[model samples]
Target: MKTIPVQLKSKDYDILIGRGLRAQIGTEVAKVWSKRKIALVSDKNVAELYLKEVHQSLEDAGFDVLDLVVPAGESSKSLAQMGDLVQQMADAGFTRADGVLALGGGVVGDLAGFTAASYMRGIAFIQVATSLTAQVDSSVGGKTAVNLKEVKNIIGAFYQPDLVLVDPDFLDTLSDRDLVEGYGEVVKTSVLHGQDFFALTGKIKSVQDIREQAEELSIHSIRYKAKIVMADEKESGQRQFLNFGHTFGHAIELLSHGSLRHGEAVSIGMVMISQRFEAVGITEKGLTDEIAQRLAAVGLPIDSDLVGTPLFFKHIVNDKKNRGGILNLVAVKNVGEPVIVAKALDDMHDFV
Candidate 1:
């Protein structure tokens, strides 16, 4: 097993990545958690797959485990669902001494992490990420949120996990489409790290290549994010770069009514923003095409003709990155170097 530490002073935690770490979750979690009661949160789909084993593992380790399952989709990340979870934890008499275990993908991680954040003003939580997106991005960053009616992640907090357990073997059960969508995050992380890293991703030929190299790829991506988060935990500066494709992507996701996966929307967002940056002289020409091609190679959409330009701009105005009237969009000078660009909400029409 390879461990990457996210050094955030008092909030410091380790991300454990390997092939069979899930089987040892109880032992691994017991090392950090002295609490007796633990809440295990998962989606229905994931619960059917790995809940029993994980539950048994915790039980064997002497934890009083309470397994909670939500519906399996983005829709489950809602105020209603979060309230239900909070109430359930209350009824079970959980306290700050107890910890939450998020045992599924990004949706579960975000929901459970946020629940932990709001429950009793804040309790500890651990992430046992099953999907590639969770393993690489959401599970490491501490950003947790639930979507509102028209916005994605509109309600959330920066609650760091106590530990993150990533077992690549869990990915063996993912559908082909679910698996490929995660490569979008891998591509985004590579681009942010720059040309050499981007080039490394270019060599991956198929989903099989991604799976075979999951350990290395996941570690690299997690390390990049960990470094940034340690520097700017509250996202006042450098951390905004991590949202390279997210601003436009979230709008597309809301417009699609969750039909578009987060990574899929991000794939298209990166291309759109790159093209706009190039046209405005913020980035060199051909960078857009390069990113689009890389995303396309991994079976992600490069562009979507269905997204209405006006509505897209409407959602951009509501993005959390927007401060006062300026939208703080992350632009690339090239593959690895990212720059934050501030634009008025009215001025956004030119880019769209």
Candidate 2:
């Protein structure tokens, strides 16, 4: 197993990447926590697939495990679901000493992390990320949130997980669409890391390729994010670079009404934003086409019919990345160099 450390001073933790790490979660958690009540949180879909083994492992390791499963989807990342989770934990008499084990993908990680962050002020949590999105992005950054009705991830906190366990074997069970959506993140990270990493992604033509290189790719992505989070944990500065495609991507997601997956929308968002950057002389002339070709090669959508709709503009205005009527847009100068541009929200219309 390869381990990447997210150095956050007192909040430091390790991301363990390998195949079959799920079976060792109990022992892993035991290393940091001992003889405590534990809550194992997962979504119905993930629970149906791997809950039995996870529960058994924790129970066998002497943890008093409590099961909490939510419905699977973006909708579950809402205030209502978060409140219900808090109520369940309260009803079970859990305290700060008892931690939460997030046992699914991004949705589960966000909900469970937020639940742990809110319950009794804050409690520790571990991330057992099953989805590629969570493994590479959401599970490591200490950014947890539930979506508001009008926007995504508007209500949340910077609650770091005690441990992050990634088992690439889980990818073998994902549907092709689910698996393809994950490549969006991989592509995003690769581009931000620079041209060489971006070129490496060009070789991935299928989910089989992603699975075969999961450990290496995951570590590279995690290490990139870890270094950024450590430098600017609160996103006040350099960390905003991570939002490269997220601003437009989130707006697209809101407009889709669940029709577009986050990564797919971001795939389109990265392409659209790259074109915008090129138009303004921030990126090279052909950077947009290069990004589109890379996205299409991996089965991700490069353009969408909703590109210039009023609904799209409406959601973009509501994005949290905006401050004082200006959006801090992340633009790429090249494969690995991203710049933050402060543009008036009204000016965003020209990009569309």
lDDT of 1 by residue, 1-352 (tens): 9999888866778999999998999999999998478989999999999999999999999999999999999989999999999999899999889989999999999999999999999998999999999988989889999988777789999999989999999999998788888889999999898776788788887888888888888988998999999999999999999999888888887788767898999998888888888988998888888888778876889888645577887898889998998999989888788999988888877667
Candidate 2 per-residue C-alpha lDDT over 141-234 given as tens digits, one digit per residue, 9 for 90 to 100: 8989999886888899999998999988888889878877888988889989876678778778777788788877788889899999999999
List pairs with backbone clashes in candidate 1. 194-336
C-alpha root-mean-square deviation, candidate 2 = 1.1
RMSD of 1: 1.1
TM-score of 1: 0.98
Q: What does the lDDT read for residue 58 in candidate 2? A: 92
TM-score to native of every candidate shown: 0.98, 0.98
> Could you report the Cα RMSD, in angstroms, for every candidate shown?
1.1, 1.1
The deviation in Å at residue 8 for candidate 1 is 1.0
Off by over 4 Å in 2: none
